[model samples]
Target: MFKKPLHTLKTSAPLRSSDRRKLKQRVIDAFTLDPELGDALVPEGILTIKFNTHLDEPGVAYLSPEASADPLWFSLGKGSEELIPSVYTLWKRPDLLPFLSTPPAVIPILVGGADLMIPGVVHHPSDLKEGQLVAVCQYTHRSKNGATLSVPLAVGRMAVAGDRIQDGEKGKAVFVLHVWKDFLWDMGGKPQDMPEQRPLAALVDQPESEAAEGDEEIPVDKLTITAQPAYTPAEISTLLQASLLQALSTKIPASAFPLSASVFYETYILLFRPAFPHSVLPPGAGTENSSDIGPGNPQNITIKSSAHKSLTAFLKAMDKAGLLTSKTAPKQNELLVTAVVDERHPSVAAHRGFVTLGEVEARAAKKAVNEEKKREKEEEGGRRVEVRELCKASGRTIGWVEGVGGSPKTLYEPTELRTLLNAYITDKGLVNPREQAYVNVGLDPLLLGAVVTPPKKGVPQKEVEFMKRDEVMKGLLDGMQAWYEVRVGGREVVLKKGALKPIRVEVKMRQGRKACTLVSGFEAFGEGVVDAEEMSEELRKICAGATSVSPRVGGPTGTVEVLVQGKQAKVVVDYLTEKRGVPKKWVEVVDLVGGKK
Candidate 1:
């Protein structure tokens, strides 16, 4: 009875096939339905799958028997020595067995470790560390009918977290695995074969050292450190070409790649054509075709051959543009001369007085001729004569009887008398002694008397004549009128009516219009005339002052004497003389007849 109970308990507890399948389907659903579940199941030695459930709950289902068989027996969680389970062989679910039974078309593995081989990878059971596990998926090109063709290249997980692939060493081969399907399949029934591995063949195969070494290592000492080359017109053309190439090859999404290259080329041509013909490449290898030199390699050329023409052209242009200057001889001398006048010696009237006088003598001779003609007729009938005489007398008187006595005068030699007269006339006009007498001579008695008398003592005679009262008044009025005119017309006035005061009676000198003041006792008389009379009177007075006497001798015995009185006045007369005949007297004074009696 005890054996039967134990057996019954064991057999009765065993899971049914449907329930096991359901559990397996649930696990597969967990990996396929939830994207994150695939990442978590990778380390758990489990695979997830998705299923269409007839049941209400649609969720993760697990199949332990399939997950624990064969390669799974390695117990990756404990690191046991057993064959590891391939990720493709993991069961997705029990109930979804038919859908997941086929192995994946390709096993995805990260390329890593020694020599960057695919085998050195972390798969199911080991945790997928960063840069470890990756899945490569086939890339497909779709046709218009929805048919798909495999591409030579594959899309892979990058060396990043979550969907990461490992980075290989330098110069080591590396690859990433990409999966085409989204879901995992159940590992049931017969085991599936791994997919074919398609490796990428290298193009331009070269050793790492050789590719790096191909670049010329210019020894610093041997290499020329040229000045940075300036981009000239030609140089810029190459740069523009490079830019255009870069713009054309720039990655455009597949959707936009359909745009034709011709259109892009035309656009570039239109945009750069104006400057392209004149552009040049900067100095360097393959500068002439720099646009064609890709990032890979460049051709070599000499510095002179690379855009030197453009540079030379630019230098010539700079010279023509007057960007350079040099020292040169001056075109003209800097010194100059200027003329100026001497202001201090300007010409004036006084400077003209020193001119030659030949013209003055010519004028005098002409006047003499005119005067001789005027006197020619008067002198035609007159005979010229000369005379000399002498007389001496004495007188005495008593109280009752007056007695007089006289002596007969002897005649003087006429030669001595004539000689004395000629000498006197030459020196001081003429002279006649009281004892000698001459008549019909060109002399006046008043003039002779004036010369004979000694000047009175203590008397001051005026050099200039003075004006009388009426003349003074006239002059003053005229002066006042002139002052008024000048004052009214000029900028300033210097005189007033009351500026002068009278000191004495006014007297006019006959010789000039000037006037002088006389003392109270002194008297002066002349014509008293009104304005018109005054002018005529003044004229007559002028004429009288200028008159001279001419004597006539009818019978030689007759005598005449003229007395002219003035303030130190004198008179002159003209006489006619017979040639070789003698006259008794030519000049005599009656007042001196008795000889100072």
Candidate 2:
């Protein structure tokens, strides 16, 4: 999974006198006592620099006390320091510079997280070895006049001995641990390299590793191959030739004396290609020229060669070896392999030992089996969908409920119920004025049942007590009906014994508009069971005025608000209690006079 880059808090703290002195000594020793740097780092001296530390990184970050220095420019790590500043300032002190310089072409790849290969390395310390820390610096020509400078951009561990790297052996050289433009470098909030007028590769010479010859070429014109499979280009070219030769010698029937180039290629692809590392098609694929599709109808698998121009070259090599005879056949669009050379002949038999067909076939078989298993596993995974639980209150749907004990929750726990009650108190401002923490329940069933009602004998329910916080919360939890929610197909569905909250009513007026009555907080009313918009219209007919229904705004609970024209507060209260069977005490009316409610 990909995650967003997070900026961890970087805090500054003053170091104690003793620790400061010791760390200063270590810095001096680490930098080899550079006179200018050593003096400037001293506390309360020519420079008054402050050091800071980051929570996510291990280091003491310090800013340059010089007035001309960029405020964001800082050095990190204990004893060791990597200057997070302009690329131009990297070589300010030549005497203390770390690491041998490298060509500029490798910078982008280093930043992309690929370890440096030995062929890409130009220079390194002779004594550098595995696990040793090294810095990668590149020479950038800043001026058209050919003036160049070196700047350090990355630090990493040596994967191979430095001597081997310097010798230009073929292997991994450096494992990049950190590089410019990584998350750590983002702290400066500026480009780590000089702003490029063109792509970075075009600004420098083409990487030497990409070209067969060490010839100078424009970098942008060629696609550089940073990494290749285990086999080299030359090796793959040879293998293709050998596979064709072996297939012709072993698989062709003696009765088929004269074969066409098309037949040879088809036989090689179907019988020989699967054993190679870079085979394009799966084994047992139907021949491109054939219409039969089942397993019993084995067909030739035609594919382009992995290396450019290798197929033509391989055929020429085979012809020159006299192992096969060929002729141009324009009608079939192929070169004909007219006859098979004698297999018992010394030249043919000598080359025959090179390609171990049995071994390649066995390996290809194992790979095919693994691929089949992977396909089946992926199909099985596609069929599975995660199930979730949802919570419901009143007649309305709340949200999905995460189940406890890895099962969908069917009943609310005492603590969970208390949390809801506490929210209700806060939302309704039901706490007693005399004592802020105590809720004064005035015969409201929701509160009275929870606080006053008791569970059956030995029911393990917390005792309810007035004024006491725990007991009050316990009473609220005990009195409420037990209900839980589960989810189905991305929608929340209330399951078993659901509870509903009371409805809230209010009135308000806008400039140049009549006062409007508002009703909300009826999640227990059940979605789709009651149409708030229709109800509002019906209320308008009864009250003889305009009305509308809208979503409740600026509230913790998501519900609908029903509004009716004029002073319909008394009418709405009456209809809800008398006609709708809603508890009269549950509905609250405010600012009825002058529409301030």
Candidate 3:
């Protein structure tokens, strides 16, 4: 169903703590998962995406937990909200979902948006029922070290019931929905490596070719040459141990020791691990590239194998061996690759060298620097808000507005439009004599069009037309083109279609008599107009109280909320208009606490 781009109906901010806990509990119940594994499967925060599928069916998916992840789960059809773990989620814990294995030749067909037929199924769980969700993969996903990995390539629903498998069947077995390289996978910011595959000739009569049935081979000139080192001994545990010693002795210097364990592992260990060649090769961007898999080109490796269970365990083992010092950091208890590397240790001194180790270390150092810069850039950058701009002044509204030298092309701020309407009403002497706050709607032709409907045909008016001044003003503005202006430092971007959102300033009671003022909706004005941290610091000084800025959950995406101690709604409003030059009309002040602020 997600073979095409789904139209997003709405997207929610991160789930609140209470809601998140409830979701976790629900997952544990549905998947029959252990509490710890279930918790790890769910991210700290999830973005709820409600969308319309290709078939117009409503669907939802939970996206990235932190920042650099993919959609965690999605569901469609009758069980729309029944979260189905995405390929990304399944990669970490493939046992969480039931899967059907097909021959390797059939995988290329499934990746091309084809549903899995009953003939293609080589293996499936006995407990599977019709309409049950399943991961689609191949038997050839076996690693070189003689381990079969349950890596999923696509997700789909079972068309045939599990109980009816004894009887010979044909047609669709799994109704293919989402594929590995489909648009949904592209939502994630991080790139993923496709699992390796090998030919399996056991499925319903098909050729043993790598490409799908009836597929043509491309010209030799079109193929990119990917050269790589031939497969050596496939014992991963041994390779990892050797790579760890090499990385510590060569890549990480004595001065660089005592580093965060995660940093050292990410920067050094992974880069130095021996590469394992496979039939389905990963892109050799940072490593070496050639058409043939031979000597001189050191390829990449995998951490998903069973040999490596956890980094902490591996580091501790090395520490026990007296080759390095690994200990929990003070206070935080985080593992630290300490500054006590045994350079003269037997393992370090007797380590053999590889041809591309130097090239690999250089790349790793460059990558670490680049990643740090990227992280800083992401933190420093702010979010932008986009709203629709509505209709503009035209026809009768323009004709009357032209008397004041206004033109059809002129763009006025919302406040300016309200002021202009009030001036027109006052100039025409249309105020109700009996009520100071009321305006006689029938007193002017423009008011008749804007605020009053003319008598239908021969119908007579039953009562004198009148409306509250604010209501009358609202009618006039509605007839004219709607406008919302954004003031971002010294620049402005006036878009069309969406109504403007005001800067919301609200005050609420906290601990007994204590109160705090909350500010939001600054995205409409842009970050340049008011940096959250800067505004918080400014408020701290002006109000002589504590203030802070933080990202707001359950609101707009990427919204940063500002908070100040005490009931400072009035002060916040004044500061916005006076100091930031935010229009008076764009500041919405609400005081839940009784009395004036």
Candidate 4:
């Protein structure tokens, strides 16, 4: 059910006191947890996040008592009026759920959303009842210390009684619910990659190797071996082209002409991609290149990473190849442009049908991607939104800009605009020979036009002999239109007509001497704009405190102020501006918690 981005995240706040205490009791009761052990496992006082999965299915997760990153014991949905453990939960307490062990070769396929067949099961618990919740794990292995260890990769329910499943049974055994690459696992936050099980795959894929595998104890060391291949843009380009071609021919019909770039790639690309070639290395390189990513799995690869380099380039190449044509479309973001794909080309007969990766091959493709690309993930807040001040020459000054080897039609960055003015003065020897601080603005007609505004009416205009260098540059800048190019969170750089307003944040105490932070004037930043509720949630996450929204006292209609608990002026200022792409100067902060400015 959760194979896509959540339909909704209605409430992301920490669970209330009553709900938190109840959840703690449930964990203790279910696990038979000892008090000392339970204290660390389900830490008291620390926030226990309780939110709905996709807005309805309840989920509970606990952070580490200290220095927690990825959440542990995080699970969604309930069974028997209690929360069932997820694959993540099973990772922490592998023995919590009874398991059905299958060959490691099929574990990859099992996680690909496939129901486990009776034939695939090598070991099954005899007492399992139909519809019993069970963990699906690869065959257990011995650690170097001679201790047995099993890694559960998925969770499912038995489709049939365990006793009914035979070695050659054709019926389904485990009805898969959540797997390693599914949305649930993604929501759990993967702290580590899926563990590889090379030995089991060898025994399962080849009957001849089974006897040898049975006699030898497979060490955990053998399972950790992995393939490392750097996926180059060329191989990935082939996959991208095949996917695009497959999408054009099969996934999206000609009638669906126009779509946003995000829709085309996010929807159609994956629908037809897996069937095409997904290999990074040549054929027969073994299952070492297996990728665990499901077609529904979210990925870091974007259109920009393709061989063609960009969406526009892909379209140009498609047009060149007689595949299809595209019309200019709107941009949803810098990465997602609009597009209208027309597959009515004459050469449509030579179509390559579709691209698909089977359950096993799909993950193989992911592994190849992981090995080759290393995901090229963008770190959170890694790149700040950069705003550049720009200038475009006015009508009379256009020629002056052109004379200085600058583009009059296009905009110039502040430094570029200043450099152009300096070049004109230096080349023409307009700088005062004796007074280097001044420049002769009257030396040339173009220079005079660029360096001076027209005189007001009722007074004859006088040719200025010399002006201070800074004054001349100021006049030149005044002859141009002021513009700002704002790069907001993965969106296209936007050009605004005038200056933007600064967002104001302040910290102060309320009547009871309890501190609260107030944020205002944030609506002025486009795209980086935050609604009160959203700001409240973000603040809650950052500050681990309650937040609320109220009317901005005596402010414009429809405006609201975000109120966060405690003194959080510095963090609010950072989040509202730097994280959202607004420049630092566009935000103002004042702290009055302890009477300090």
Clashing residue pair totals per candidate (backbone < 3 A): 50, 19, 13, 17
- Whole-model lDDT values for every prediction: 0.25, 0.48, 0.62, 0.60
**Per-residue accuracy of model 2 over 382-498 as CA lDDT, tens digit each:** 322222222322211122122112123345565565566677666666677788767766524345443564457988755433455576665444444456442222334334465
The candidate scoring highest on lDDT is 3
Model 2 accuracy (lDDT, Cα) = 0.48
Off by over 4 Å in 1: 1-75, 79-188, 191-597
RMSD of each: 67.7, 21.0, 18.0, 27.2
* Stretch of 10 with least lDDT, candidate 2: 293-302
Q: In lDDT terms, how accurate is model 3?
A: 0.62
| Candidate 4: regions farther than 4 A off | 1-378, 403-405, 453-463, 488-493, 508-515, 521-534, 549-561, 574-586, 591-597
Give the TM-scores of the predictions, in the order they appear.
0.15, 0.30, 0.34, 0.39
| Full candidate order by TM-score, most accurate first | 4, 3, 2, 1
Worst 10 residues of 4 by lDDT: 292-301
Error of 4 at 365 (Å): 24
Candidate with maximal TM-score:
4
What lDDT score goes with residue 347 in model 2?
57
RMSD from true fold, candidate 2? 21.0
Q: Candidate 1: worst 10 consecutive residues by lDDT?
A: 1-10
Residue-level lDDT tens digits of model 4 in 315-406: 56765675555555445333333343446643434554542533333444344334222312232243346666778888667889888777
* Tens-digit lDDT track of model 3 for 394-471: 554665667655777887665676777678778888888889898877666655665443468889855547789888
